[model samples]
Target: MKIFDLAAGADGPEPAVATCSRKACRSEASWQLLWNNPKIHTPERRKIWLACGEHRAWLEDYLQTRGLWKETLALVPDTSSAPIGQDF
Candidate 1:
């Protein structure tokens, strides 16, 4: 399921911020870790994990150990008018 921080004053549900993928981490994410399991996912399918500065290396190492890591890049907020949940 998708998890999003609630915008306190908004009438409809809205995303307040993008958070780290690490469990129980509430810090805002600054990096995007791209990965996928070769055994389960196609080569072109990329899965994303958001990571805060403090956890980037840890998350990368975890993925790398499993031979799942593809790349790491700075997180850039999307400005397009695409549907919220379509990409995943």
Candidate 2:
């Protein structure tokens, strides 16, 4: 299990590939863990932690213990959005 820095995001360049939030796992993320630390963030604010199939349960358990887990959802790629381009 890798110690991942969630804020750092996937280890890559533009058009970033979403990877598991697990420290060192490079597997593509399959689930989105949406949560918020009520003590630090606003109620409406949500922080996302991506998880691959293998780490989903572990991550969820971690967050749930802290009472931060709000919801988990399948990570569906957004096809409607246009890819990043040089020309704006």
Candidate 3:
């Protein structure tokens, strides 16, 4: 993964915000690990999917085996202003 240091005091456009890709899972906490895995994605880019608390483990395993597990960050969908869900 190409890790870049954000310029000092330079908060780039709040990051490319996205919603969970899963339809059955509605909780905003749903997120997938987006990173470079030689077995899956290219090392120079970021990839994402949706995973709720119930599917976190399974998703992690899937990504880990492909060697793409870089970081699991929490996300809040733009549909609501309030904290909609909790991360597991």
Per-model TM-score on C-alpha atoms: 0.74, 0.72, 0.48
TM-score of 1: 0.74
Task: Flag the better candidate by TM-score, 2 or 3.
Answer: 2
C-alpha-based local distance difference test score of model 2 = 0.79
**lDDT of candidate 2 over 1-88, digit per residue (tens):** 2453455467622455668888888898888999999999899988889899999999999999999999999988755534422110
Give the per-residue lDDT of model 1 (tens digit) for 16-86: 56688888887988899999989999999999888899999999999999899999999888765343331
Residue 85: error of model 1 in Å? Answer: 6.8
**Evaluated with TM-score, which candidate comes out highest?**
1
Clashing pairs in 1: none
Worst 10 residues of 3 by lDDT: 79-88
Better of 1 and 2 by TM-score: 1
Q: Clashing residue pairs, candidate 2?
A: 2-23, 2-24, 3-23, 4-23
Give the runs in model 1 whose Cα sits over 4 Å from its true position: 1-15, 80-88
TM-score of 3: 0.48
Local distance difference test, candidate 3: 0.58
